[model samples]
Target: MTRTDELIALEDKYGAHNYHPLPVVLEKGDGVFVWDVEGKKYYDFLSAYSAVNQGHCHPHLVETMTKQAQKLTLTSRAFYNAELGKFDKFMSEYFAFDKVLPMNSGAEAVETALKLCRKWGHEVKGVNPAAGKIIVCDQNFHGRTTTIISFSSDPDAKDGYGPYTPGFEVIPYNDLAALKNALKDEEVIGFMVEPIQGEAGVMVPDADYIPKAAQMCKDANVLFIADEVQTGIARTGSLLAVCGNCSCENKCERQESYTRPDILILGKALSGGMYPVSAVLADDDIMLTIRPGQHGSTFGGNPVAAQVAIAALEVVSDENLAQNARKLGEMFRSEMQRIIDSSDLVTKVRGKGLLNAIVINDTPDSKTAWNICVKLAENGLLAKPTHGNIIRFAPPLVMTEEQLMDCVSIIEKTLSEF
Candidate 1:
């Protein structure tokens, strides 16, 4: 067997069968590209699910991690570390949140945010402890944790995860009326949503949906929680997906379209894919509800992760990744539309910024999208399918215009094969 086949066999023999990954086994990665074990190069269209927004193995993040690693790594929450305070101050000013609850992964941040919401509900909102409910949208892809999967519409993630956590209400995404009606419940303490549903095939809501929803939540005293784990850090052409059409390069100051969330959950690109780092941010009134001993992670605010995250956020701003994503996204969609105009295989292309997707003209159960992805891999590009029929195409935001057009050409050629 070949090296790729041997590696695949080893994984099949030892690893858990939870993930159905694409066959390619990558070994090396740089900005917008990866090479497999055999050294065949391909454009990295997935960007580790938008975790490597600063591009793979970024020098700044590597330097920060390495420098911090030489000094210290983890001190846990038991004792305060030097980098943690700096991270707290930097992130607070970076995202404009009064406080931050650090965690190791995106799921942990979501859980932390949920716990914070529940705590705020009971302590501040005066809701009965067991009676409070947070509203979540249908087809949301928050995470795979049992509590998060409880309200999931996807059968694969939800089924068999029995005795699921309760206290969450399901509402249709982007439906203002449903949100308005749901807010009428006095027990409703928060509305948790993704500014752009990334995993559900890059679903973008109406232009007015987010701002209007925030206003409604404000009117009803409900906390507007934005889970920007997948869509944040310049993925959706903004510092945060909730920034709306505003294209500011740094921490947003709430422009006309900016829908500021009361509670913000961030992850993925926080460390530029060098280390695990996630954070939940909120103002003093909401975040202070959770005392010191209530919640924390051992490696949440570690020195390496802290410094890496600072470097990563700096990369986003310094490199103008958000602005790059915004400009390139428009270019990409227009190119995809040009292809779709004459093609029969691709029916639609939709998304904002670099986080985009193309719908294969086939049933969700069909293997068309998967086959296309395999072909895309063969043709020197890599992308993955979501919900079977939709193929998500999110590349690193550091890609230049020439590189993007080259990728577009590769995509056009690949689609023609179908």
Candidate 2:
């Protein structure tokens, strides 16, 4: 009878049941909040998996998209578009990279990085041609592609998705010794990992792990690639988590603490959750190895994507979302810690910036996180469980202190009820 009911019915009738989305069907959003078709308001804690770092329907990004759409949307890679060059220049300058290769999704950027690394191994590093091996972290969440999933430790991601691709060696995350052991093989070309495993439930490694791992890779002539699709763009209160200080030099010491990736992969927030625009950034040698016809996407670097991305990056800088995320994230984590200390149901709360998670001691079959999320939905906050017993709470960076406190209160109230 209602619009929400009609939408659900239509989805059940026509859509494939791939994702188990929450019951609420959001019809509109602004900044940190979204409204459902039923006209109920809820704070969006997930931010579409850290894509809306600039917040939902950011005016700048929307304006850019609208203006660009009116002028031009697509012009295949065969011919250069006006916006693409400007966007590439802006991105290179913003990230301090020599060059960038654009793609459509986080997974595509990741795939591009993999290809680039392998090609660089053969062409520049002079490793055995076609024998390059990339060392990946165990419990990694790169993407859903066959090659990405082939190295996945999660059974659900890889099940029935064989025959798998090879040339990947899985090593335990944050363990410098294991990474050293994996790279001892002459065929090893690079170490690919998420600075913080986002989909693995906001898993942050040891403070010194990434820097040490990067040093080891550098010593072994292997590239250190950071897949920062979820952790980058101020999601972790840094422009790139590996970069430490995403927007300024005040945190130079902190920036130096983490290992900077040789090849940087970014997506999601790159377009401010407006459109899918991912990219691979590298210095000349690693990025240039891929010649024409090696790899590309038709919609990868379109005019619309270019304009949207430029606006998105601008919003991240102009709004100071990183600093906001840092301050609010600390407040959130502290509040959650207080709750965790008091509650017996929650085992721990862990994460950086707005990207956070709480572990439920209950069994997976209990769907504790799911039940909590349903309660959270009823309380006007939205979040989703990553795994069985872990719930990820990552709100957009544009949230105010009052909004964050309100969200914290909602969470506290919900947890108390549980």
Candidate 3:
């Protein structure tokens, strides 16, 4: 059997049948490209769900990982490590947060935010300990954790996962009236949402949605938690999508006008897709609610993860990836719009920065996006459908203008064939 067939057979025999991965088995990657087991190359358009914003196997990140691994990998939460403090300082300063709590995954960071909100609700906000409620948006994708799923509006994500955790109320994404109604109960403690719903096909809300929601939360004394796992760290042009504009040469103004979140949850690109490193950032009062025994993780703040994350953040800033993503994303969307205008199969193209999507007019059950993705694979670009009818296109931030144009040509060719 071929290596691909052997690998598939091994997975079928030994691995859990949880994920329905694409047929391609990637054996190597560099920048925005990946090589399959058979050596066919494809542009990595999805960037591992926007995790590898710095690109696949970034040299700096790899060097940091190697050097850190040679020095120290783990020391557990039982004792302090040298790199952890440095990373904490770097992250806090970079994001302008007072403190940060390290975690292992995006879901863990979400969990940390939830816990922090709950604790702050009771301890700081003066809400009843068990009665505080957090408002979430419909069709939200926080993570796969049980509590996160409890508030999910997607039936498939929550079908068999119950009895779900309680205390979360779902509201419409862009409707301020719905949020006002929800918050009128006086028991609401926080508002947690992804600025742009990444997994929900890069759904960008109304321009004023985030700022208005934040204002409402502030007026109502509810914490505004921004889940920037996929949209943060320059993925959406700005360092955080909640920030209004992200012009490359206008960093100072953008930073000055940046919308500061009460609670910030980060992951995925936190380590440039090299390692599982996530963090929750908040001020002293909000973060201090967690006592010594309240929360901890074994590998959350390990030295290796810290070093890797530092390099990842450095790559983002030094490479000015945010600017690159903005320029390239504009070109990509414009190209996609041209294709959509010509093709009857495509309905719409929307999103910001590198996080964008193409919508198919077919029913959600038709798997049209999946079929298009298969076609795209044949044309040498890689992307995955989010909800059967929508394909997200988020290439690594390291992609060049030429590479982006090449990818657009591939997408155009595939769509034409479709």
lDDT of 1 by residue, 138-222 (tens): 9999998999999999999999888999999999999999999999999999999999999999999999999999999999999
What TM-score does each of the candidates earn? 0.99, 0.97, 0.98
The candidate scoring highest on lDDT is 1
What's the CA RMSD of model 2 in angstroms?
A: 1.6
Top of the candidates by TM-score: 1
Sorted by lDDT (best first), the order is: 1, 3, 2
The 10-residue segment with the lowest total lDDT in model 2: 245-254
TM-score of 1: 0.99
TM value for model 2: 0.97
lDDT of 3 by residue, 165-233 (tens): 999999998888999899897889999989999888899998888888999999999999999999988
Colliding residue pairs in candidate 2: 45-394, 239-246
- Could you give the candidate ranking by TM-score, starting with the highest? 1, 3, 2
Which of 1 and 2 is the better model by TM-score? Answer: 1
The candidate with the higher TM-score, 1 or 3, is 1
In candidate 1, which residue ranges exceed 4 Å CA deviation? none
Task: Quote the positional error of residue 236 for candidate 3 in Å.
Answer: 0.8
